[model samples]
Target: MNDTPITLSRADSSPPRSRSATWLSLGIGALVTLVALYLIVRSVNFELTLLAIRSANLWLVLAALGVQLAAMLFVIRRWQILLRPYPTRYNELTQIYFSAHLLNTILPAKMGTLARILLAAEMENLNVGFVFGSIAIEKVLDSLVMLLLLAVIAPFVPMPEWLRETVTASVLLVLLLLLLLVSVARFRSALLNAVTRFETRLFGAQSTRLALLVRGVIESLMNLTRRRELASVLFWTVCAILAGGLVNQLLFAALDISVPWSATWFVMVVLQIGTRVPALPANLGVFHYVVILALSVYSVNENTALAYAILLHLVVFVLPALIGALCALPISARLFALLTNRTQPTTE
Candidate 1:
């Protein structure tokens, strides 16, 4: 019997997939750099030097980072809360730090999703299929909640035609996803049996594995099936969303610019969705490109917009990354774990 911990097959041939993702991501990055440069050069205030760091809204930016951090803390707490019924010991903040942004920088696709799943699986020595199914459920819930917040804040802003269309389509997509999950939950047994039947007809041992995977997904969904549990998670989620909105608002506030609260929500939603489209490391170029595009359409001045976009990203990106590294290495030799987690791209 293998008593010591055994690492799973790390020879994930997923590197081939990552190689393709990298080239595509790099292209976006290059385009982003071009766009940012264009905006900076053409801006009406190109002659204006940046405000000294001392004179700028240092307190407000720090406060914004604090709010963002707290919002993430709440999300971690919410995840821990949701898993209360399960046997799991996730550190509220540490997991979120590593799972959301840190792994986001390092992983490909939705490796942050996989990171949390892998961490949970390792810590509890649980089934990968079941743990990962929880991740899928979590992702769906996250998308739906963000869209719901976006919808609620929509009425407060004068949205441009482009954003309005995007939001409308996204809302429908979110609805479709929610309905699909509900249908699966309703007909889980039939779905499972059908999948098992199909698998058995095809690959024998592989079908057995597929059936197990199906069961795990279904079981994870079952964990959230209770109205009480769902409601509890939603309550905390609502708080986090509000906190996130504040962070977005403060991002603009730090620029000495005022956008409608609705605009803040819009930017946050846009940035979250935009960056996921396979950008370069740290979203290097694309971050400025998307934010500038979004703000320009909103009639924000180009110079102020570029300044706001880059500065806000620095706060949100670099600060969290540094903190994530520190937190991961605070006590344990997880410094290597952080390096392992940070250097390697995520496997969604």
Candidate 2:
């Protein structure tokens, strides 16, 4: 049997807000990007950066590109496995995944995930909560794997004071995430009840549909904790993490920079944590800065590190985004139609 479908429009998902607030968000995002770009331009020598890019090993660079694509495939497979017990077309999901990824690389504050979730729910007629629940589970698994890898490799890497602080910060972040998951899992009913009362009071008659969506989301979260499916989710997530590390190592080789394969975990950790900081579109300056900092810990030259960061980010961000845009065009049209036709006012 197919999974039950849940329909949602923007009106159902987002609380009504003012246009001025939307403009404020865009203005802030634009300001952040401009500042980040200014900092990057000041720091790197354009001539030297261009020279470094030209010097990269083309064969290894191509191989690195291949590795990045494979890594994405692994992640999508993991998502596929997570969405199991709910049948979905593999090809359709792949398109949505890539399209969502493209938007994510371009947009700030991770709107890509929600865009994909809403698009997928609209197209597949799947429950929004189920799709979102799978993504949430993916995040939890990613955090745990990061912590485990760090612990296993910490002894080998020298414990400089700065490194120690970074490790500590990462640990705290993981723990905080874990605590949040536990709280939600344990107290879902209370949380849902509180939110439901607020929505009903605020939205009046419109609250009935919104309350149902809230219930669907909470139920999906609860259902995902079931042991059989959870195991598959965990296993595939590990593959995705390992695949990420491989992408880092391949990019290192592509740049002809020597670092221990294990050290790539440090690169992976730093890169992930760094990008989490709010930045302009495509993670421009933030990605390069964190990569250079991570490699500098191992005594890599700043120019070479900058080159590596630039090439890797280009391959990682650009290629998929271009391809995903092509895939998303038709899908996005359908989503647009759904948004226009299905949205209704809260009072109605």
Candidate 3:
């Protein structure tokens, strides 16, 4: 049984807003990029900075990249496993990694989840439900994993109560949201009934659209239960996040900076926490300011935090373009456009 939900018209959907949004997102991202570069320059002596990468431990660089790549690979596998109830191509997983990262590099977001789903759905002729659900799972698990690590450091890190409270609020908010999803998934029919009734109350017969949405949600939940291949996906996600924590620790170490593990974890969590919020693409001005602020609690000098943020951002950001460009080599590269336009096939 194919569990993916069929999307009828994706091509006509040119980002809901306008061309202006595209331009705005680009401008925001570019501005952020410049600010980050400026910080790197300010952080160290000009001549010394240039020589640092040359003189910096190449092993640390490779280690960081390797850990990140491993995380991406596991993410791909997780997505594929989620699509298990339906037909899928595991080899195609790389395309998702590439395209998602491509959008991140050029657009906002740590990854282009929407683009990733469109690409996979079109290529496999499957629906988007499983993919969408899997992405949700990724977000939840990533947050949980990050929070779990922070929990360990909480007792050790000497930060303001407000910071601790904020993290707690963030974690709890996310947990509540996921709990809601799990609840709806478990009691889908009741939720659907409520949705239908609510629509009837609002739009009467026009509630057809809302009714359909409820149906879709129910179908998504059903698809998820078809198989559980990636129980280990969550397992590996925890490992990957831990590995990332270590990478940050090493980064500080190589720079001759000493931050308690808890402090560094807090910094890592905060840097990513900001990106998750919807903002201009590539997470422009927000990413930098947040990173700098997050690190300040650790008594980390602004210069070092700024420099770390710049390089760290690029490691996850620019690095993908290389891989995305490579993945684009396949014939399947056009998959997303095709999926988007599936409702109205373009005439040659």
Top-scoring candidate (lDDT): 2
TM-score: model 3 vs. ground truth: 0.77
lDDT comparing candidate 1 with the true structure:
0.63
User: Candidate 3, residues 166-210: lDDT per residue as tens digits?
Assistant: 777788878896676567656877876887788789978653454
Off by over 4 Å in 1: 1-49, 52-54, 96-100, 106-110, 205-207, 328-348
Instruction: TM-score each candidate.
Output: 0.79, 0.85, 0.77
Candidate 3: count of backbone clashes, pairs at least 3 residues apart or interchain: 7
Model 2: lDDT equals: 0.72
What is the number of residue pairs that collide in model 2? 0
**Better model by lDDT: candidate 2 vs candidate 3:** 2
- lDDT digits (tens) for residues 1-348 of candidate 2: 125555565566655445576466556766765776676677777788788789888887777777778778777877777666666777888898888888778765565786777776766666666677668767767767877887788777764576567668878877886676566678877877887788889878555665666655665555456787667666766776776777777778777789876678988877766666566667877788778778877888777888988887887898889988998887776655443445453332
Superposition-based RMSD of candidate 2 using all C-alpha atoms, in angstroms: 3.4
Task: Provide the overall lDDT of each model, using Cα atoms, as 2-decimal numbers.
Answer: 0.63, 0.72, 0.62
Worst ten in a row by lDDT for model 2 = 339-348
Q: Give me the runs in candidate 2 sitting further than 4 Å from their true place.
A: 1-3, 16-43, 159-170, 183-198, 335-348
lDDT of 2 at 70: 79
